[model samples]
Target: MLILAATPIGQAADASRRLAEVLASADVVAAEDTRRLKRLAAELGVEVGGRIVSYFEGNEERRTPELAAMLVEGQTVVLVTDAGMPSVSDPGYRLVVAAIEADVAVTAIPGPSAVLTALAVSGLPVDRFCFEGFLPRKSGERMRALTELVAERRTMVFFESPHRTEVSLRAMAEVLGEDRSAAVCRELTKTYEEVARGGLGELVEWAAGQEQGVRGEVTIVVGGAPSDSRTYAPEDLRELVAARQSDGLSRKDAIEQVAGETGTRRKDVYDAAHS
Candidate 1:
């Protein structure tokens, strides 16, 4: 059997009793960070009895099969990440696939999740929602990504690094509109946890005011486009492309952004822009 466990996103007290028991008794424990796993065990007042191995992004591809093999050998292998459930935005998806392929029974100990935490406190409608793991780091890629969500009517959740929060907010504002409602959740479930709710434009300003950049783990929640949102005309598409181009995107990327934003064919957007 393969157990995928969830670690506390912030406060150590949130670790479940089942998590403690599994950590102490699993035949093998694969953690995203061995050191953090040790610390967590210490906090639980339980000593892990299993062989501990590292299973993180840097080595997940190489380590997944090894963990799966242990499961095949009739060992109870437990997989865990530094925070949240394994295989979320964290490392564990590959191992899950490996376990399934190997006919290993896989299960999870549900616990804290930053995506759900942020959404709950976002003050936005959550009846329909989607989680967009993380925005692209590059400006053009990020803009294109946001443009694709411009017409998404479900509330959107995104994970972003602290340093890139401001830049991401600005890009979101440009592509999704400045007045779009959003919330920036930081250090969730921690001592300094904060959730800043406002328009995209307002969030951008708040992030900019942070002298050391937004700190700690961050999650972004943005309200969806209105159900009755207006459709874009060819001229409007061309204008949007021009705006993105002026913001330093290449002509090709700008066209892609406008096409995604308006759900127009890329060729049509190109023709409209050039016409």
Candidate 2:
């Protein structure tokens, strides 16, 4: 059997009872960080009865099959990352796939997750939402990704490093609109946890005001565009068209491309541009 366990995103107290039980007795334990796993076990005061080995991004490729082979031999192989559920912008996905292909039974011990925790506190509509993991680090690539999501009506969640949270918020303000609602959650469930909720512009200002750079694990939740609102502002459309034009497209072609990209009719975009 293959068991995927969720570790604490913040407080060790958040670790599930089931996770502790599995940790205490699994035949083999593959951890993202062996040292962290040991620390967590010590906190639980339970000696892990399993064969402990590292299973992080750097070693998963080689280690996944090793663990999968254990499963094939009928050993209970428990997979865990440093925090949260496995395969959640974390490692463990590749092993899961390997298990499925090998006809191995796979299950999970669900517990604390930063994505849902952030979304629930974001003050945004949660009926519909999507997890976008992490955004590109480069300014241009990040902007392009934001532009692609400009029309998405589902609340979007992204994992960000503390240092890049402000930059992400600023880019969101430009592409998604300054007035768009958003929340930045830091070190959730931890002693110094913080959540800032407001419009993108306001959040950007708040991030800038952080005496020290934003710290800890960061999760950003941005409200979706209104269903009836134009996906792109007039300025956004114009800039997009201008970009296309600079790339050798005629004005008409640029408008057409921009309209298609924004899900607006070419006639409507043409009228908006000329208005």
Best by lDDT: 1
1-275: candidate 2 lDDT, tens digit per residue: 99999999989999889989999999999999999999999998879997999999898799888988889999999988988999999988999999999999999999999999998887889999999999999997787778777767899999999999999999999878899999999999999989999999999999999999888999999998777645777777778888888988778767765774577877777876776
All candidates: TM-score: 0.90, 0.87
lDDT of 2: 0.89
TM-score of 1: 0.90
lDDT of 1 by residue, 1-275 (tens): 99999999999999999999999999999999999999999999999998999999999999888888889999999988999999988899999899999998999999999999999999999999999999999886787688788878899999999988998999999889899999999999999999999999999999999988899999999999877546677788889899989989889888887777776678889998998
Q: After superposition, how far is residue 266 of candidate 2 from its true place, in Å?
A: 10
lDDT of each: 0.91, 0.89
- Flag regions of model 2 displaced more than 4 Å: 229-261, 265-275
Cα shift from native, residue 18, model 2 (Å): 0.8
